[model samples]
Target: MAGSNFVSEIFLFPLSGKIAPILAMATEIKAEPAMVLAGVLLSLVAIYIASKAGGEFFNWLGFPPVLGELVGGVVIGISALNLVIFPENGVDSSASIIVKMLELTAGLAPDAAEVTFQAQSEVLEVLAEIGVIILLFEIGLESNIKDLMQVGVQSLVVATVGVTLPFVAGTAGMMGIFHVSAVPAIFAGAALTATSIGITSRVLTEINRLNTKEGQIILGAAVIDDVMGIIILAVVASLAKTGEVDIINAVYLIVSASVFLVGAVLLGRFFNDTFIFFAEKFKTRGRAVIPALTIALFMSYVGAAIHLEAILGAFAAGLVLDNLHETEVGRELEKLILPISDVLVPIFFVTVGAKTNLGVLNPAVPANREGLVIAIFLIVVAIVGKVACGFSVFGLGNVNRLAIGVGMVPRGEVGLVFAAVGSASGALSPALDVAIILMVIITTFLAPPLLRVVFGEGEPEAEEVPETSG
Candidate 1:
């Protein structure tokens, strides 16, 4: 708590002077509408650019770009550089910034400005939420539904063992060994269970082992990991909202999420011809991608309508369109979705990064030590837990146990998605959120080099057909 408190005050004091005058001046301005739009646009640009810079820097270092984006977001966030809207101390953050803007433009007193600011922040939060949903949506599109069928029993065994071991180990380690409470512990465990299909598959593709037995197992297991992780997320989200997990509630979420996922995919497949027919009728190139985008949004909304995360619905939507890859409609849809994903997904990651209040990491404050220790503990579990999955890859030809194990290690986007929803639903406290992100950061960076060792680095023949991120 001390470290958390210390961090909050760092930016709070500077904000009082720097931001208040801008608000007051903006309040005095006659052009209120233009200013608000300008303010929002400026904020959006800053977020994207900062995120990109961080992502690229990390990429150059041989780590995943998303990892850098998260780190960049934290650096520019209100906690550190006051780059984002909200500050930890709750002094001169979003609400107050809004208050000043309104006061200058609307000529209201401090109180009125503050109230209006609160309302605006809720909208920004929703935007940030949607960003992540779209992210998972794109990830789902990359992994797709057909991946589940290609690899067979060996992959299933690897996936099942891979998923189960990490989860149990994470849960048990937190609750039994660390004396943590169950709800948070469950979430902490859930975070450890995800594997980054996009990153893993890309590595395998690079090594030209994608068609190999071990490669199939790794990719298939990663896909299974994503699906299982999403269901677990739904369960944890329900508990986060209620401040605890209940057996009946958990059961309902699991069943409902499972049913919705299967139903969405099946319904989409059954109607795929109709969708293509409707899509084909369109003459305007400008509007061609709408049908696919519409289905994605519709599915996402339905998932939320049933109390599951919109991401689950989005994932299913992608699965339904899995075969669209070879069609004109698929090409058009990809053109539309990839840009949207590229723009919005970084916002989601940065927001997750912004959630960290680095005060907890300050050495002067003893409480930060707890966060650091827990993070280290979780990182160890994330590695060992995934490494253990290599043992389950039975009946495979020339399997690199180390390679499969290393491939499963990076949590990447999926881990961040889990962390975001958990934080949003109140499953993770601020400290725990930072801890999860730290684990993601470490494992994401560690996985690539270790994988290179197992596969050996050199260009291989280009894949005839790129494997799905799965």
Candidate 2:
């Protein structure tokens, strides 16, 4: 009975002062049926606010706003301040959101809390998944299919080498040094497979060097890197789900992923023309952006249908678009997609942050001390792996090797997605999960500042080395 009252106190009121006093009082005494609904609403509102505030603060401090979002989650999450109890384990009161909710119900029913958590988790997953799809789709919109091929032979080599090195180091380090199981190690390596183009490109743009050969190479490599990472993600995700990585199944995944990406871009061309034709006709009838969004959603399903990741389909859909800016309808569709992406994308990041159990990093705790060590090792591999890409170029002409490498260091959103996939796939152990999250946070925090310093004004530029086919 005491526990029940304690739970009610936590949930029945707002966490920070977002609500009026009157509303808080009324919500606390609301009848039984309305209790659950109020709790969910409170969670959503609190999470979103925390996420936005975190993002803004990080952005102001010269870091990616996403880092702030993750911080916000940690601050409210049980791992840090314990301000909010989105518990990691229900049996242990320390981590269960459901157990907290159960306290509010008069009967102290675990079933009620369990049911609510399952429902809430499902909804958040769908929404988070959608946000990631939109994120990849936005990345795709930045270039045409030809851009993938246009990243010079050197860029392609760099991307390939970059991804290969990290996977090997991550897997070997986890197994040998950390004594981790193979599956979890594979997930760790897979998480490091992509460079955050958003971070790298921003620094280049800020310094007016985006068009430089070094910058171009980084951009090209980033694109190829994302494709490689997503394909790897699909394969590893399959391995985690099946509990065994069959050779035949691995080959099949590779083939399917490749075909899906290439085929989608090719087929999407025809669909784009057809879509535009109809969109133009219906422009006056207010059916403008439907075709664009519908295609993206449809392709997302197609990806999952064929055993490829849904983001791959969303990417394919974005590639299918021919820059809908020529016609009125096309212009409208572009505007419509951005706002939707903005709204949905933050929810995913905030949730990822909130789920990170920071308590695992405490050196005073024996198990967590080990986790901190693993996190440090993983962080090293993630940085060195991508930084090595700077050297993959055969010709170095005025390219600052350190800058190019540092630019690739930020894992950003993609790493978050990879970790989320592992968690949802039930492939990650709690220790491993915390390690990956730490890696993500560190990488995300490091890149922007490093890039600004490396490429800051008046820095001496290295002379370009003549091109050689490596």
Candidate 3:
């Protein structure tokens, strides 16, 4: 009864009043700012421990470390340990071990627990958003525009086929067979379009096939897939936000994103010298990276200002900076950016895992049965649609069409980005979100071994190398 009253107070009153039950008989209280900060600090500890442990464990097991981070998040999140939780729907501070620890040790009054939890969760979410922006920026820096252009027609065909098949099939199936609403179906379809360049590239490099013909096509096609996936992501996210599509708005986003990408590339050629000169002039410690980040942030702002996703801007900035990446300054910039990525990027992945409720997959729950069926359907579509891209390769004799198709299979971190955005927008029901997440996990797990089998390679040589950061 008391817990119910507390929940009512939280819902009925403003934030300031929500913390008052202990301080006064009436519902009015001033929260300690220190308590909120304390909560954030504690949450970070949990996030980092989970991320590192999960990553190292997965890396040891010959899987992508990011997957381990995801599973780690699952272990610590609402679905498991409850070390890190959000105040979504029926969830409250009572379910959070972190909040409980705070209450026990930090003199955090019971009445203020909810407010502190809300504040901390908001901070973590901001960190996760920043993490993804940096992630796209890093992806841009690594992609070779010249090389991607060289692969040209074959890659373009593969990327187009890869994106189109999954999107058309997934969206149509969701609406026609499952009777899902259009926007959610579109978001789900968009999620299917992502081909994780990071995971694919790592597998190729490991098997000494990175320089092979099939590998080049796969890498180039994956880059193109990333770009297409981004555009699709921007479009679907917009659709999900509005809950109804306006043709004008959708077209505007598509045009604006294209112009923004092309314009940045063109404009970058003229400004490259000026950028270097300005960057070199700085005597400060963060000279190289600071200017680069400024560009990324400015572009991100422009993307948001134009009602496109901010990630589009950051990605464009990375492409603009790609030319400079080979220089001494660029090497330094890469070294610097990596450590930052190591710290923040996992937050994004883990948070996505944490938000996921695997409970929805339980067959014992009557409502979940539909979600399970949809998940199976999505898994099949995710595989078949991407594998079909291999058969689309034309005019190349003895090209391993199977390898190229399997290479495009893993959704990796890119798929997670779609899932996160969709879930955040309230566009996906819990069941549907979990379904998408399951598809991502299955695809990510299957692709490496499947790639090895198709390429006829033995186990990868044991060597330490930096994993791709997409």
Candidate 4:
């Protein structure tokens, strides 16, 4: 679950100071409420600018707009221009252009700079979390629950194979080849098991394949992958703390996640009617979307409460409401959500890019040299491990197996979550952590273009409209 909790857990360090101090006043200027608000506004300016510029540039280059947003984030983030940065170990808050701007214009004292930056960054982090939840909810809305059901078995196989192969291969190789300790090796392997549903789904939607058999299979598998990933995360985190796994906690997570997802979907039939009932009676503006958004948020909350990713609940909520496609409310819901999605979704991708610290890639650092080598090995495993999932399909004739495999390639934020958790727990060495980050970055950027190739870059065929009854 890439919830707010995870966001807080990951950014333990402050941003590196980029701009020199301009004020040395004896009286420390406290960061007032207005000062914090100013900082947040500045950060939003940087975020939207990065999102638009990157998205536009990438679209022109014949790539996914999401890819460009990520690049834009990297360009402005700690990796490049330092316009937006997060709290990280051994970094200066002064490095944030947002912070600097606030200091100069808002009279933010040097002493309160870090606090203001932290507060501003936290807001971004929460927004990013919400962005992803909205992304998943949007995906769920687009998907057909019945179609997903049809491919459930194949998806389960693909997800199982995807998780097992990467976990086993990565863990064994780390221990056997690099002589890494068992716990860290397991943690790294767990990181490799993640397949970013958001990144892959966005690409599929871009190519107009989200409803295709191959697309449905990939979407179903990615959801399964998330459930499995959470279970794996729980296990590894426990191992990190105590040199052994906690079987009971692992079992509990597995059971709760399964029940939550199944329960949400089964109850969606009930929800569909309830949603329409409330929507029709409201007659006010936002009637359809407001009720729908309420469901998404509630489902997300339920998922989070159950120790699963809140996105799961949101996705499930979307699936529950899938039947609404036949109704006027359903059609209105989609139209309304798109505008909101346009604004929030980019924030998630950009923040993922910004949070990525590229300093680990520099070979000039003696410690990074070994990590680079490890990173190469991990990257290969990460790609090959998920790519192999395409072959796991059964009973489906003429399925685009390679596309399925390639679709699973990008690790995106999910992989980052694993890396962050492992690093925080002291289960990963610096080199190993760097290697995982690189693996995530490469696979994430690599998969979208590869998907475009495998699926063919021609104009997508017009979609078949779902049958509707008055």
Clashing pairs in 1: 23-100, 26-104, 26-105, 27-103, 27-104, 27-105, 28-104
Model 4 Cα lDDT, one tens digit per residue, 153-249:
9999999999999999999999999999889999989999999999999989987889888899999999999999988887788778777776777
- Which digits, one per residue and each the tens of the lDDT, describe model 3 over residues 1-470? 43233323322333343234234532465556798789888888999999999988977876657667778888999789999887652488889999999999998999878767776776787788788788767776765555445556888899999999999999999999999999999999999999977667656755666546677688778867876886677667656765544455446556766787679878877656767888788888988888888888899889766655576677678778887865777887888988887788788778867876668667898767777888898989999999999889898676788888999999976897788778877899977887898788788768877887788745243321223343
lDDT of each: 0.66, 0.67, 0.76, 0.85
lDDT of 4: 0.85
**Worst ten-residue run, lDDT, model 1?**
2-11
Q: Against the hidden true structure, what lDDT does model 2 obtain?
A: 0.67
Candidate structures ordered by lDDT, highest first: 4, 3, 2, 1
RMSD of each: 8.4, 10.1, 8.0, 4.8
Of the pair 3 and 4, which is ahead by TM-score?
4
Sequence-dependent TM-score of model 3: 0.78
- Report the Cα lDDT for residue 35, model 4: 78
Local distance difference test, candidate 1: 0.66
Q: What is the TM-score of each candidate against the true structure?
A: 0.72, 0.73, 0.78, 0.92
Instruction: Write the number of the candidate with greater lDDT, choosing between 2 and 4.
Output: 4
| Superposed model 1: Cα runs more than 4 Å off | 1-36, 85-120, 152-159, 175-191, 194-245, 398-470
On residues 288-370, what C-alpha lDDT tens digit does candidate 2 reach at each position?
A: 56667788889989887655557767767877884565677666776777788778776666666666655566777776666
Q: Number of the top candidate by lDDT?
A: 4
Q: Model 2, which residues run further than 4 Å from truth?
A: 1-40, 78-111, 152-155, 174-191, 194-245, 284-286, 394-404, 412-434, 448-470
Candidate 2: pairs in clash: 87-95, 87-96, 88-95, 396-464, 396-465, 397-464, 398-463, 398-464
Q: What TM-score does candidate 2 get on C-alpha atoms?
A: 0.73
